[model samples]
Target: MALAKPSGLYPCTRSLPQAKTRSFPSLLQPKLHPSPNPSLKPFDATPGLSLVSSSAPVLHLRPRRGFRAPPRASSDPSPLEESPQKDATSEYGLLRRATLVGTATVASKILGLLREIVLAAVIGVGPVATAFNHAAVLPRFSSSFLGGVNGPIHITVATTLSKLSKESRRQLTRKMLNIMFLIGGAFSALTYIYADEIISLTAPGLQVLAQGNLIREMAMNQLKLMTPCILVSGSMAVGFGCLTSEGENTYLALSPSITSIAVIASCAVYILMKGSSSSSLNSPLLGVFISSGASVGSLMQWIIQVMIHKNSERETKFISWMDFFNDKDVHKLFALMLPATLSSGLVQITSLTDLYFSSFIPGAAAGLSYAHLLTMAPLGIFSSTLILPLLPTFSRHTKPSSLASLKENLQKAIVLCMVIILPITCTSCVLAGPVISLLFQRFKFDSSASSFVSSLLLCYSIGSPLWIVRELCAVVFYSLGDGNCPLLINLIAIFMNGILDWLSLSVFGLGAQGLALSTSCVSALSVLALLLLLSNKLGGIINIRDMRGPFLLLLICCAISGFTAMFSYRMLQFFLSTISILRLFGLTELLSILLAGILGMSAFYLPLVFAKFAGVFLVDSLWTTLLNR
Candidate 1:
């Protein structure tokens, strides 16, 4: 008896000749087509149905005349090829990787916060702390713009390497590393030699202070100590990109904690030697110790990253030194790096501008630093985890054929960022005072410091979402191979930031808080301009009308969350006032902040779920992913 063909199975050709009958299990059938050449061996098609093509130009389905079908020839392509389902699975894998990276980032950020807390307690917002903070401007900028996970150097290396062949990438990595090392070494030498001049230029107002000479001297020494960071910073950034591209994201995501630990250890040693004595807390010696710790921490960061890159499975062969200047890919990296580096430098210039204006006001720089730490804790976690992973995906989708996918990804990224960050920004703004009090209002960090820092924190909070959007938008520009657009945007932003800084400080009498506000305003305006330009570039990929609904919803949710958090905090504070025991050691403030944040987030999330908002889907997906792991 003839066996029936499996349902939904059909031959690609209509004409065929009769052949021998075959009987086999239906499920094991291999779907195949007749070979054009009759001399070719017969191949299985739908298991029981084998296709045998003859010289007569007709194909025949027949029994295999054996119990098992012949093995697929080594020369034949596999039956399983790239399909939509496979592509989806690959995308899912990328998402899983991103989720893992994000989780590690959160852990790292928590450790970083602890490190900041330790520094605040040990150093306080005194002269030494202020001087260290000011002197750290250059090093901090270098790390953030160069060695940072999403910095210019990192982005350039990651983007360029993704497009090159395996052998080409190996050649390029060695060349880039060689070039960066030389550049970094020269920069470090120059920085070390001119530390005094750089400090004088950056913080000229320091010379007019009561302890101007002491502060200036300490700052110069601190700058000298941190000069080596210029060398390490470039290497670290390139290593981060290399490791991440090779799928070793855990190391890059968690490496900052190594630096944090190093700083914490250094502070711990200092505290041990001092024996809880506040008298010598802000001494010049302590400043030197902290500065040295910071430099050591940076060196440690570079060492760990380099080691990880070397040990990774994707390690490349070391190329000759001449290749550094001759490789086309290395030159492309330089082309991309130049504009990206300039863009990042402009951002640092904003920070420098703030420092310059802040120098006239005592303790303002330190307050700004403290406030910035709090703002960055959440931003860093979200950006490093979410934005960094999406960058490679974005670069992959930059081709004209994939523009639609790129547009969708960008829109989703923006919406997701708004959903997750908006509530935090609102809560921070509302509970700024209590949060700062709980975190830093202890030991030498007094109530005055808390007040000033809280004000700056609140102002900085207003710009948190803006900062995230700015970063995401920049990633889009970078992915599209147009780093100059972001450069231009930042240049304008720096100009605006400077003008606003002057007006807020010198004219409006806002002090440090005004500086923070100016940054927020500039970031907000810059992101809007960037979005407009990006939309035009992509043929109106962003529809303002479509965005308005989600934007409005998120705004409402944030406002509600902020109000609820404020009310909850006030009620808790009132209740704590009635209980004397709860007021000790900032217990009341701590409890209030915890309770307020919990209630606020609960309120913020519950409404979104009830309303079935678009953002809720992403939240659900992320939560599900976490649970599955």
Candidate 2:
């Protein structure tokens, strides 16, 4: 599965490379202030109180039944012609939604982990697995770029819909859905027909191997089977954008787990039918089965979203060809799609670049896939939960008068990402081997594979914070209605990434680790560029000097947590050998990881709790919930 983007929604971009997982991250903006016209009052926060900022997006907590839009007048303005001053205010704070998102997301992630484990047991990181991963890259990339949650389509829809009247939103959505259907259909056909050529470019190294042709054929077949996913995903994104704009984050957070479940079920069925012998399970046909499962999952997502929309008053209808031609909103949506697609989709494109390089290295493609699965878990959960709710808020407060409040909220968001992600990164880097082994060291997944994936995971972890920061910064630009800045920066980053990939693999000889390393380096550059440009655009809204103290404190705290966890794990491992009860029961590895993780978390949180930083609120809430439970 793709890890949701740091922007706070499910991003298929980080999804599967093994399944060629490509995902779009989610984007949410803040609540809007009441319109001066009595008939046009927007959703509001409770009287005289706001959450985090005056510009936070208002969430529609209660689902309205039979909600009807105001009747259209003869003089009703075209959505494209409307230019209202948008300002958002949240009745509810981020904490409540964050809690809901966190619970659903964490559960989803756990299920995703289980899916990966099942895949490893059935396929291992062998040639078949590598081929499947390679084949999946193209379709997943296309789906995520075009129709995945938080992809350009979703962003454009969510951003645009939030600013429109109910009647306009309903009409616009219908037209958009119809257009996406045609585009997605044509794209799917092209992908299906060109499967061989696509696989050749993405996994050229397969041709050089002894069984290269065999692997290549398998991948081509899998790609053809999965092509329909792109078609279904496009419409799915429109649904997600609609739901997200209406503040239906709970479903958005929960939806991805369905994909994982479908994949797992497919594997279970295959194992049952073919028998569980390693040789029987290694057939290329299993990969095809997995691809079919992914397609089914995509279709299910679209269907469920359609059902949900039909229930909502904002149900979409098929627009006539003439209406499609006449609507200016359709033209406007397409205009936003181009820059947003490039900017939001660079992560997948970058992965394709990395995959092209990886094709030359044996087992490298599969290794990268396995490693990324672990690295993306926390990012998908925390980032989507924390940041996704702020997009509307940012959109509403872009005026000069609200600049200071916007800056403060942005700073708070960045600080929270650092406080949470940094500690987890440190802990993961120190405990990479254990985490990898604990998750995927059974059946067909051997000890050697675990060791290989561990190194890649460590490299991927080093850049986790960079990924979060870059996406967070990008969202700020997007909220400011400046997609061009991120688009331009990403274009530059891609070239830089290619050069670094060449240097890391061809020159430094880092192998698969080199791919992850190059990615981190490129993200760091992008993050810096985004911040500097954002500063220029916002009149120095953010200052490096002001953040230095908090940054340093976080780094120190993370270091301490890492060391403490490492020490605890090692000590536990040592004691496990001497304790007859534990050794006899075979609880050594499990207990060691458990205790170490708990201690590490405690070490990280206690200091920040004492520090009285803004991040403390999150910690305090989580701790309170755990204690009460």
Q: TM-scores of the models, in the given order? A: 0.85, 0.84
Give the true-structure RMSD of model 1: 11.2
Name the runs in model 1 displaced over 4 angstroms: 1-94, 313-321, 576-588
Per-residue alpha-carbon lDDT of candidate 1 for residues 487-593, written as tens digits (9 for 90 to 100): 99989988899999999977899988999999889889998899889888876655565446556667788878988999999998889877788766648877888
Candidate 2 lDDT over residue span 1-629, tens digit each? 11111211111111111111111111111323322245532223232211222222323322135544466586955432212112222223555566676788888889888988988888888878888899888667765546765566676677777677778888888777777788889989999888889898878888898778888999999999898788877777777777767767778777778878999989988888998887877798799889988888777877888888788865666778899778888777767766887776776778888999988888888889889889988887876676556666665557776665567567667756776788788889889999889888988889999999999999888878877777767767766677898899988888888999999988999888999888888888888888889878876645555456656767778888999999999998998868889889878888998888878867987766565444555455544644544
**Deviation (Å) of 326 in candidate 2:** 2.9
Cα deviation at 362, candidate 2, in Å, is 1.2
Ten-residue segment with the worst summed lDDT in candidate 1? 49-58
| Candidate topping lDDT | 1
